[model samples]
Target: MRIFTGVILLTLSTTSAFADCGTLNAPTDQQLSSKAYQLQYRMEPDGLAVSQDFSVLFEVCKSDGTAVEGTPSVDAYMPMHGHGMNYRAQVEKLGDGKFRATGFMFHMPGKWQFKFDINEPQGSEQLTADHMVK
Candidate 1:
């Protein structure tokens, strides 16, 4: 009987820990994931425009849905052209795993890759999402 009670308590504690990690409020435009993390992002002002500056709002969460700690960085690059954006994006933390990156421009792009670099104490990882501009 004592062993059964201990097992029940252990199970409850583990379940509650994961329950605290909730999913993102709404669906995002794009999502990228690795073995340990998941990133959900959406471009500000809805759609992409050529040669126009915009912002990207994103959030990084652990595989268990818990918000990740540490600051992350964002960047854009054109693999085919071998060049990146003229301006560098400024990243801001909005708490609870949320972040916003501003000053992004696609400047005559065909295929652009949005890079999200997650730098945490555990390790560092890069996740990329592809977008096409008309």
Candidate 2:
């Protein structure tokens, strides 16, 4: 039952990601999506640094390639390690679905997942992207 539940959850999450963000195509390594939002990620300092402050920028859009407007949130987690970042990232709106997140860091070298939550007219959904820190 637990396995079944996990499968269902995974399916739902993947479906939601594509439903709102458009067709899945990896033209770059910085884009992620969910049922109601498409998020493009940009990291300041151009790379990952453990235990150091970093800034993230997100350009959000709809599945039909339209700019979105809403409240956006950003967070970082390490699934393998079963833990999240010690710092709580804060997001600021930059108009037209563009947002900036600050004061977050990986704090270790491994696979990290970044999640973006956007609340808009259509409702709220979360998009995710993974980054490998070395």
Candidate 3:
């Protein structure tokens, strides 16, 4: 009986933790998917502006809808210009597969690609999404 109760308590706690890190349902401007994960992100202050620094909040989940674990990183580049962002974005792990990235700036108005990299014990995958700045 005691063992059963303990198991129940542990299960509940684990479920609660995962629930807290539940999949992002909020509206986001950008989303990218790879074979292993799906990512959703939105820039702070709503829109992108040239030469303006902005932050992005993003969430990642596995194909099974479970939060992704391991190291996550973000970066951007302009394929046409063949240059990346002048400032490297700093990533903060918010737990449960959510991350906050700051120090992003789109120096020029053109087609830019946001790169999200997830490195896990199994392997690593990169997801890219395109954004245009006016």
Give per-residue CA lDDT, model 1, range 61-94, as digits (tens): 8766678898799999999999999999999999
Question: What digit string (tens of lDDT, one per residue) describes model 2 on residues 26-92?
Answer: 3478876555456677888678877778898778877655677666788999999999998899888
Against the hidden true structure, what lDDT does model 1 obtain?
0.82
Higher-TM-score candidate among 1 and 2? 1
CA lDDT, candidate 1, residue 92: 93
Stretches of candidate 1 exceeding 4 Å from the true structure:
1-29
**Model 3: runs farther than 4 Å from truth?**
1-22, 26-29
Which residue pairs collide, candidate 2?
Answer: 16-35, 17-34
Worst 10 residues of 2 by lDDT: 18-27
RMSD of each: 5.3, 8.4, 7.8
Ranking by lDDT: 1, 3, 2
Tens digits of per-residue lDDT, candidate 3, 1-134, equal 99999999976865554445446664645767665677888888778999888998989877656788775999999999999999999999998788999999998999999999898777889999888999
Which regions of candidate 2 are displaced past 4 Å?
1-27
Top TM-score model: 1
TM-score on alpha carbons, each prediction: 0.80, 0.73, 0.78
Score candidate 3 by lDDT.
0.82
